[model samples]
Target: MAAQTETVQWKLGEQLYQNPLSGEHDVSDFIMEGQAAISFPQRRMRMENVLDPKLGQQANFVFWCPVEFPDSIAISWDFWPIREPGLCMTFFSAKGANGEDLFDPSLAERTGIYPQYHHSDIHAYHVSYFRRKEADERSFHTCNLRKSYGLHLVAQGGDPIPSVQDAAGPYRIQLLKWKDEIVFKINDMIVFQWHDDGTAYGKRLEGGKIGFRQLAPMIGEYANLSIHALERG
Candidate 1:
């Protein structure tokens, strides 16, 4: 028999969710952790942790998308900072440590706490794009990329988005992961780029789920969430 090469079709990635962030979407559409609330304050999906800011760490919460995405995909969304002095993080490539589905009943239940996702049962890569939550973060603005199962700060770069006072935006944020390289950009300006050498934190993480996390008291509004595939080289 003659040897043949395999051919594959490449198309723009299938959109997982393009929510208007409006009230029309059901609350049942997402998996919630802690005390996160979704309200269409102005017909756009606005998420804010109901826990008081003074609650500090306990005030943090996460909202996970109902879909699992492939590795070589581009995750993009529009963000507006409604209230400041809060932190924002997006967790992706997440799954149970034992290779089980993220929602497998056998896994430990998640309660919107930080440790549950990082120290306990799940493994993921979370990026903080707008980090004005603390005194130090306000003085120095930067975007961070972290891999977890343990908090390993792999990359850091400047954050260009202005504070809520001077902001007039539905800022475009994008994170692109192709093979071992991950790049983050805001408004087309490259923030940080890192290549996983596969020696640290086991190996390059593969496909998993994505979630939105916020440190309470910071009301952030998001819309037009999407994921698209890149042509693999």
Candidate 2:
């Protein structure tokens, strides 16, 4: 049988949200789960753990953009890995399993722990692009995409990012989600593409919120975060 392929047929429409994420006031209304020391040392938002790293997951945190986005959209941002021995993730299509707001007071409270997210009451798509937390990660770099309500890893691609020592970055991280397709790229280079059939990973995840999560002891700087609606060509 001939292999199948999907044609690229969508374009980014009007931007839904944009933030420099550069200074103190840029994130004034942002919501945070767990504890992190957020600063703007180089005019770029820097985040790291406040609790001792030895505390494990308790020392990690998630900073949310607070804006709910539609199912089809394009998200772009600039990133810099300052320090490692930790991991970073992007959470999207997130909401209470019963369709409550991600921050809905009625849902279970979350504090940046891994299980509290995957094994708990919410559903979200998680992508770990900068994964250097474990010994294996440091030795073999890979970008992973997982769907949750359960930690089901669905796609993976080679991570082309260099380690901190050799990284000279303002790496443009881009994610595009349209219908069932998810594409991830760095500096215009395609890293991976997955087409979700919906039923395989529970119900198809639609519109919800987006958040930036970091494991303890990792320091990263971010700027120019923007989201554009995905429109069919």
RMSD of 1: 6.7
Q: What lDDT does candidate 2 reach at residue 133?
A: 97
Best by TM-score: 2
Ten contiguous residues minimizing lDDT sum, candidate 1: 1-10
- Model 1: how far residue 19 lies from native, Å: 2.9
Candidate 1 lDDT over residue span 8-50, tens digit each: 2234466655655566554467888788778887777788887
Scored by lDDT, the top model is: 2
If scored against the real structure, what TM-score would every candidate get?
0.90, 0.96
Query: How well is each residue in 5-105 modelled by candidate 2, as lDDT tens digits?
Result: 45457788999999998899999999999999999999999999999999998999999888888889999999999999899899999999999999998
lDDT against the true structure, per candidate, is: 0.81, 0.90
Taking all chains together, the TM-score of candidate 1 against the true structure is: 0.90
